[model samples]
Target: MTPLSPDDYTAIRLSLQVATSATIIALPLGFAAAYLLAFSEIRGKAIIEGIINLPLVLPPVVVGYLLLLLFGRNGWIGKLLNHFGISVIFSLKGAVIASAIVGFPLLVRSIRIGMESIDKQYIHASRTLGASWWDTLFSITIPLCYRATLAGMTLMFARSLGEFGATIILAGNIPGVTQTIPLAIYQYTSTPGGDQMALSLCIVSIGLSFIVLLLSEAANRKMARN
Candidate 1:
């Protein structure tokens, strides 16, 4: 194995940061969406579901381009953010947004499944016992679905850590700023005599993914036991 360079370390760190930020920002939103889908007979539910899952089915490049259109400097929201001195494109923050979009569907799916598995009778009981809607959700629904939420977060983190197409398009791959592991690996592979570095990064990515899967399985088992 080649000795990892400072750049490689930076890349790994940035990847983790991006993944963590993405997962954190997306978690509450995912849970809310899952809950809505699971419990509500709201109008346009199918349309909302399709929109939530669109990122998973659409090409990553397409998603990235859409983000650029919606969040780029020249875009509507982007211009507003810029007026407030917040920039999204070509920055680490942009990477986080890109990663979140890419991982959103998986997070939503996992949480939705968990919510669906919850017994509606429990909710009814909680309400009959005079629990408020928010209280019931926090005390019962959230605790019961915690394991699945964690699993969803783990999967989203893993997916975000290895994201390339969206990150590259939205964040511009600036080293130490937005260059994540996958982008770094791609860069290494393109340089002369950089195969070892690329291999090392590839191994790191695989290791991260493996750990996420193991943790998810463990969480599932624990939930099952309880």
Candidate 2:
């Protein structure tokens, strides 16, 4: 448990890659989604929000199956991608996609809460100063909501790191490719005499999650004081 094996290290590395990739992919879209849900006056706002948040309530396995339907080689988007010699199914890219989908709701919700809590006075002032929507977004909205965005990203990162059901279904547990920490732990637990290995991975997972939470809190405190 103290020392990790090469395969375990690989799993950790893959997890980091998947989580980071997922966060990066979701960042801009998540912010846009949060902004829309918080400020938009569209008639279908609730419907859009529910669709965005479906992954949170739906089973992860179900989400994965849906993704497969959309991105499998024979599937619509997957066929287009395959025509270009790109592959997603059962690949690292698939793992990132799965993690991103599973963690998207958390990212959107956190930013939405932060944006909604912000005083509208600053926005009005920015508008009065002749700042355009894009300008205000960069100069006012984003700056004031930086802490929230960071917190959301951190939470989403943690979620992505722990993603299992969707990832296993879409990405598979192929070592050196899509075998993330959770998949590795599952594999170890299922094997005979592999309890010790599974336990070690579990501890590592707990430690990493705790560290991410602490870092998120520290960032919030720092931003609050600044």
Candidate with the greatest lDDT versus the true structure: 2
lDDT of each: 0.92, 0.94
Q: Give lDDT tens digits, candidate 2, residues 1-226.
A: 6478999999999999999999999999999999999888889998999999999999999999999989997899999999889999899999999999999999999999989988988998999999998999999999988988998999899999999999988899998889999999999899998889999999999998899899889988988999
Q: 86, model 2: CA deviation in Å?
A: 0.9
Candidate 2 to truth, TM: 0.97
Summarize candidate 1's per-residue lDDT along 15-111 as a digit string, tens digits. 9899999999999999999999999999999999999999999999889999999898899989999999999999999999999999999999999
Model 1: colliding residue pairs: none
Which stretches of model 1 miss by more than 4 angstroms? none
Which of the numbered candidates is closest to the native, going by highest TM-score? 2
